[model samples]
Target: MPKVIAQIYPSLGGTSEMSRHRPIGRDPYAFHTVMHGLRQIAQAMDELGYWGLSHVEHHFHSEGVEVSPDPGLWNLYLGQYTKRLRHGQFGYVLPARDPLRLAEEIAMIDHMLEGRLFVGVARGYQSRWVDVLGQRIGVRASSPGDRAGERRNKELFFEHFRIMKLAWEKDLLQYRSRHYEVPFPFESGIADWPAAGLTREFGVPGEVDDDGALRGVSVVPSPFQDPHPPLFQPFSQSRTTVAWAARNGLIPITTFAPIETAGWFAGLYRDEAARAGRDYALGQNMGLVRSFSIHRSRSAAQDAIERYEMLAWREWYGSFGHLGGFRFPGEEGQVPRPGEDVAARLQQVGLIIGGTVDDVKRQLDVQLSAVPFEYLVWHLPYAVMPLGETLDQLELFAHEVMPEFGMTPPEPPRLRVPESSRERPETRASEG
Candidate 1:
């Protein structure tokens, strides 16, 4: 059965009433609402037998949407409330962060969660925050078009990704890339370091040279999982990204791509993995991201989709030209214009599945059977959907639709009493 991960958008209050409040993202009440809703959803997912739960990382959402700034901290907060449900981001914007700092934080989070952690990385597209945060490194955000910008962003992403891997897997790191140099000034290294002697004595070997200069640095607190946790890369569409992920053993989660397009990427991933000496079946290490709404009737499901998803699609994502990628197989041309029915277009492409339990099962059957994806990332618009409705949808899917795909709720864990802690029958009788 494919593992199902719930990816929440974490949009601060955008309800009709709350929308009146300017910049709801900054509103204390809205913030409280989102936090409370997240806790409820986490508990529901844990009890519903979700394989994992994740959130996105975006910033500067003064308009009160997609306000998840610190995904690592959010994951840590949610992980404390649930047992069994793994936590992660859908992913962190790599170019906007210091790779070494990110590595250290994720490692600490992994230990805090007791290994119930997975990681995802992304080449950021949001200029609002990415450009500002990455300014220190001379990095800029880019999209599908701008060839020059995209090239630079890809280079930075690859370099930072490598640095993070080195920090996780090795005892000490000495890296030199276009954007970074470990121990600063790779040729001369850090000279006259106060802790050089102590680092050499207590830290990993080769951290300091004979002259008491820091040569290599060790990233402390390696991940709880050996060699780091499972890595994922979301929104993968290009062959270059897919191939790189295959070579690096990262799961590529494709979103907005039609089934045929996704299958083509899956084939490329399989071929690339084979070339990299890690044989994988088609779709074995790939994932698909899709939005869904389930209800008793198809029309009700459509209403749910409209109430929960359409505003964000039309106003937020559409403005960025993201809706352009929602084309169906063999249906070529521009996406719906400003006044067109974006929801209809999404349904036509099967990107947004909505209907009764049977209806949803049939829709998913078509896609999952077509590509045998090992992971299904279920995108939930929790910011707009009411808590009760959201829980109902999750319960319906977990109990009804998921079973059609051979998925079932896991058995409740049994608490085992240690032999030394158990009471003896003779001692109990004497006490009585």
Candidate 2:
């Protein structure tokens, strides 16, 4: 049996903010707001039996975009506030970053969490970010064949990870690379310009190594998870990414592939895993995530689904620049317009289970039996849904729906990141 895991996203729209992706919840998107009543929220998940709540590391976006911005702090705060909640963050954009600093933060967090950490890696979704962060542009930007941008992102990520592993394993920091040179660069270039070598051209202050070679400073603070935290990679429409993840040992979290396509996607992972001498667990490398809402009565479920179709999906679904997921139960044109049985739509995706408790139970049993997914991340506080009502819904979920999955809602993930590495670098959004 696959152990069940659940997640909560901290962005206001994460679970608590339902529909307001239109205007900046924070004008200027700064001076963040403090979350209220975490105790109640934690108690609700714990009692109802969820596994974890994850903090996403998303980015800075223009008017028509929304993504998680400050996962570093969000992860820590939410983890500390709730017990049994496992914490997760996919992490700062891999490119345009100092890997040493990233290594330090991940290590610290894992130690603090006492082994309850799930770390994911991604090249970021934005193409322009390469130019913004002083990287070469026009790599894989035009088409799938032109995957220069993504390939570069993957290269930098793997190189940094190699160094990160070294930092975690060895106490003596000495690795020689084009990026991080050792033997103390400052010591090597004595007769001419000291350790400050050609690095100045790239804007990095050069230093000397003990071996009289021009080198740079070593990254400090290794990671805490032994052999490092579990790595999960993001899934967009990139076939290269999927193949790369399979070659390497990475768990995958995907988007864009709807539920009907889930088995098809699962087949991809399983096939890759087979070639690599590994069996892909249903929820391990492949997680099928969708939105869910459980109402107390069947009538209420019907009403909410009705309201969702007529009022919610059209206004907010494609508003934030998302192209799909607009069709709701009973809505005129959802993606899998299989038919109008709201119950079937609910059963199909396992996302909005709006029936009475027993009805919810039947729906829950069917979905779980079908997917056995590792994690279930609710979009709580869905657009137009108020926080109070969100809380009430959570309470109802705990009471009526949670038990069907057979999980103990693990402690919220731990707050282990240090003060220095608490802020994630912003990854821009997709123009599409």
Candidate 3:
């Protein structure tokens, strides 16, 4: 049976309705509501038997879309409210962060969650935040078109990724690369007299040399999970990334690819893993991320997609060229015109599944049969859906859809409310 993970995109609800407030991302009350809704989702998913709950890491969203800036903190906060559900980010944009700090934070979070943590890293695509945060390191965000920027970003991403893994797996760490040196001066090391004796006596061996120079650093309180928690790379579309992930034993979550593309990537990953001496079935170490809307009627499901998802694509993701992912193999260069019904296009390719229980089940059956993916990530658009509606969809899928795939929850869902009270008034209007 496949593990189901809920990927939360924390958009501040009702941004379109609150024009006077403009960017609801800055509204404390709205932010509070989103945080509370996250808690509610976490608690509910724990009961619904979700394997994990994940969030995204983005910043400076004054327009109130994808406002989850600190996913690690969110994981620590939500971990307290649920026992069974693992918490993590779909990913942290690695090029924009100091990998050592990220490693330490993740380790602490892992301990706090009592081994219920996973780590995800990404080569960032958003310049709005990434360029600003990465300015200190002279790093810039890149997309497929920016060849030079993309290469630089990949270099930083790969270097940072290795450093984090070393911190988790090794007792003492010393690293050097084009962008970073662990001890600042790699050759000389830190010549500090303070705490040298204490560290030599108490810390891991070789942390300080005989002459009292700090030779290596130790990332304290190693992860609660053995060695470290599972690592993941999200929205993995390229063949290069799949091969790298396979070699490193990191699960690659395919979000934008169509089933045919995803299946090809899965096979590539399997072959690469075998070459790396880690043999696996076609989709055993892979995940697929999909948006879903389960409703009583197919049209109603389509309506939900238009209301909750299309606006975001039109205003945000489309501008970033992400909507192109919905294009079929031959239509890779096609771009949607203004006012195009992108929701329908997405559905035509089966990128976003929608319909009644049976319809959703059938669509999933077809898609899953193609790849046999081991993990299914439910990408929830929390900004547009009310807490009640989101819960309703989760419950519907957990009870009706998951069983067909052999995913049985330990306990029945316990958060069903009367239909009349499900839509909170503040979130009734769709976000712009």
Candidate 4:
């Protein structure tokens, strides 16, 4: 059985009822509310047999959607609240931050979670985010469409990733890449003279021999997991990156594409793994994300779907829906321009799985039969629904839908009925 994960975007709801083109207003109270919701949802997942909780990292949003700038911090806060369910960034944008810091933080987080943190990385796709981070870090602002910009970003991503892994693998960080140069001398330990003199002054513990050669200074707090935790990268249409990830043993996760497209990527990964001499199984390191919501009846499911579509249309699709330009196998590879058919397109692609228990089971069966993956991450908590409703849906899905997949979700904690709502046996008999 494939592992089940859940994701919730901490959207600050505003202007969803207004024009889709209009900018959304941020509600100051949303932070507390969303965090509360996350805590509740995460705790429920921990008890209900979810494999993990994944959140997206984003920044500089005036639209009041996707405000999580630091998924690591969120994971930390959630780690304190959750027990067994793992937490991951659906991923951390590699080009936006320092690699050394990224590696260290993740290492510490793994220790914090006792090796439950799934490290997901990405070279971000948003131009605004990339430009902002670039300018902040004194790099030239680059647009998403600019070839030079994209090349620079990819280079930085690969270079930084190399340095990060080195930091985890070696006792000391020693890296010299085209993009970065670390001058810390290490020969069994730090080398003597200029480098050793500076490093010793900083209270690094290493003995200087008669030959004045320093020895045994290492990077602090190695990862809890041997070598490092599992590395994951978001799947993309770029065959080069996808193949590279497969060859390098990083898990590839994807969403917003049809089953055929997902399977094609899986096949591509398997082929690349074979070339690299790695024995890769079809579904072992692959994850697919899909929207899911379940209700008691078809009418309720349709109503929820309508609400979800309206919210997604005004807030999500209206904002970054253009990023879903990924093409499926047997389809024209042209990126479809966003139009009035957004909802229909999403439905046709099987992105949204909102229905009754039976309906959801059939939909999931069709999807899994077409494209099998090791993990299925449900995009949960549509902002249009109340926290209660979302929680109810989660419980329903856990009990009803999960069983079909051979996953037995534990019974959720029952809510205590209020004394006022409790009926006495005598009163019930008289009423009857």
Candidate 5:
């Protein structure tokens, strides 16, 4: 059986704002309440033998749906409180930030966790994040009328990722791409001109040398894991991206899509890995994230899920309604259209695994039987559920559902990179 992980999209009392129909009841310390609740959830998952916990990164949201700006920061905070549970970013939007800084941060966090960090990178989905960053980063200005902003996003994502990989594996890094010119001069002569190295030319006080350009730059403190930490791509709906991830040795993660849709994407990854002459293990790499709730009765579970759907799914489906889903029971060969009923959309998408223990167990059995997945990340601590109920739900999952699947918290992977040697260069100065 694969590991069962917990996934959280932390809320800061904003659920009420997203929908009045299922408003989050007033709490004076909603922000503090959510943080405390998350800590408890992390502690419980650690004690209850959960494989790990993963967080999502979202920003500029007034709706309070997702309050996490940097999932890595949250992962670091939770790492201190948990004993053995791994921490993951379910993901970070690659095109929106500096990948080199991200790599260094990830390496630091991985070391803090003793090499238990799992990284998931994505080309961002939200228009607000991508467009705003595109303008701020001058991508939108440079590439006018390109895929309405998607072309630059994909290009930047790949370019940044390429540099990040080099930062991890290379001793000295310099690269050139259509999008970026890394370490501009391509070589730093500090080794030869130890006294005067580009320091005077750039007007910075240092080991002075005009010959040294912005070159020989490397992400110091290389990752604790050999080569790099485990890399994952959170959204696998795109066949092109799935194939790319597989070829580049990244685990592809899928959720909210139909079972068949996820299965197809996973299949594409496997095929690509095979073509690349790499052995692909479903239990080690393939991940499926699903929203779930197990209750005393099926009707009780359904009612609770419906309330949550109003708060979350309505907005989600309304915004991303073009995806294949939205059908009545037994309805086949129907294409999804926008503005469909949220309940129908949820059902069609197989978005929730809510019901009694037996009901959820059955759903898991069916899905697992079809997809030889290795990781099952349960979306929990939903906004509609009170903190107490959410904790109970996680405990219930740990005790009842995980056992049925023969799941257990996995042992921490043995680190392959030399830890002490990497830390020795912590104070090494370099170019911007």
Candidate 6:
């Protein structure tokens, strides 16, 4: 059976931080700090025996979130720090990045992790980001994410993904597409020697197109995992995304309204997979504790939760938001800020966990037993709490509550695997 592969993205900001292309902090090291802390967290998780950690990718976040443009660096950093902790990126927004460059970097990370990396790919959604990349969201902006600019970005994504796969799997690569093409011939003297067997499987190697150009092409250091690390699509709460993933055999990470809601969506995804004749063996972590409070003590937690309620009201329910006065983080044209119906706003998205770690655990289990999510990530914004406080909550969760959830920190690379074998493919593959 595929063990549950859950990703915990301890973002600096929460949903509230999502605004017009703004990130939580201006300091460049915001992401770096998170990466450093993640190693510690991963170390703890390994000690406690947890499974995986995934980082979020966003161009702009509301208040306390960190957007990682160069996630490859973080991946490498974490990969070097922990031995067996599975690392994931909840996707690199396709159009906002250079596909080929991203492909090489992603391949390197895969090699570094010995294939423990799972990729989540999506078309850039926010208008702010799309614009930054010089893409347009025009009339489609009104439609939901998948519908707006969906076709172009998805096409670009698939095109890039296919190309990346070809580059990684093939020896001398030849690609000719409308927008991109590269041909390599046999005489290019490309040195391709990866320690991992999976690298050879990723592409078909032969230099030169019919034009007979020297094949100097090779993806350096093939992926560390076998075959290839999976490609997960962000579930858009749409059958389109789900069915597409099901048909294509993609793993998925999605959000649920609450515990019961999570179970329902997971069942939907599983059913779609089954119906599509795809492997049900693929794992899913579709639970999200969005904009929730995790506090060192009950009082702080309660106060934060109340503030979240207020935030929900201020952002979504209040009249200022409703009449189309404002726009979503990635929207153009303009939308009303929102109307105030604080309770209804809270009702819009449920806060399933609030009280204590134990309280959170009980609620989480109730949802997990039904939906069986492989991972659950929390969205603890920086609005109400300080970063230090958030860290305490994270530490506490790692030390106290994670054990109940059957998760513990990973062992150091040396203890987890023989140091001599760290350079060996056998060691990395087995770790996965």
lDDT of 5 by residue, 1-432 (tens): 878777777765435544652333233355567777788888988889988888887776655677677899889988889878889988888887887898898888888888878898877767666667656675432133466566777778888898888889886666776665556433453344443433444333432334533345656778888888889887666678788988899988776576777777777778789899887754347888778868899888878777664565565535654334433335566445545566656654666777899888888788888886888877664554677787888888888988888888768777674665576577454321
Q: Write the per-residue lDDT of candidate 2 for residues 178-261, one digit (tens) a residue.
A: 555444352353334453444344323344433434444444444555567767675433455666676677766655444445
Q: For candidate 2, what is the TM-score?
A: 0.67
Q: Which stretches of candidate 2 lie over 4 Å from their true place?
A: 1-23, 27-34, 37-43, 46-48, 61-67, 126-151, 161-166, 169-219, 235-239, 258-260, 274-285, 302-354, 381-384, 411-432
Q: Residue 286 deviation, candidate 3, in Å?
A: 0.5
lDDT of 1 by residue, 84-158 (tens): 888999898887788999999999999888888889999899888888888887778876577877788888888
Task: Name the lDDT value of residue 400 in candidate 2.
Answer: 57
TM-scores of all candidate predictions against the true structure: 0.92, 0.67, 0.91, 0.82, 0.84, 0.68
Which clashing pairs does model 4 show? none
Candidate 3: residue 58 lDDT (0-100): 95
- What's the lDDT of the predicted structure labeled candidate 5? 0.72
lDDT value for candidate 4? Answer: 0.71
Residue 185 of model 4, lDDT score: 46
RMSD in Å for candidate 5, one decimal? 6.1
The alpha-carbon lDDT assigned to residue 144 of candidate 4 equals 59
Count of residue pairs whose backbone atoms collide, per candidate = 0, 47, 0, 0, 5, 60
lDDT of 4 by residue, 99-146 (tens): 888888998998888777888888777666767787655443334557
lDDT of candidate 1 at residue 48, scale 0 to 100: 80
lDDT for each candidate structure: 0.85, 0.53, 0.85, 0.71, 0.72, 0.54
Cα error of candidate 2 at position 74, Å? 0.6
- Candidate 3, superposed: residue stretches over 4 Å from native: 18-20, 330-340, 409-432
What lDDT is reached at residue 132 by model 2?
A: 60
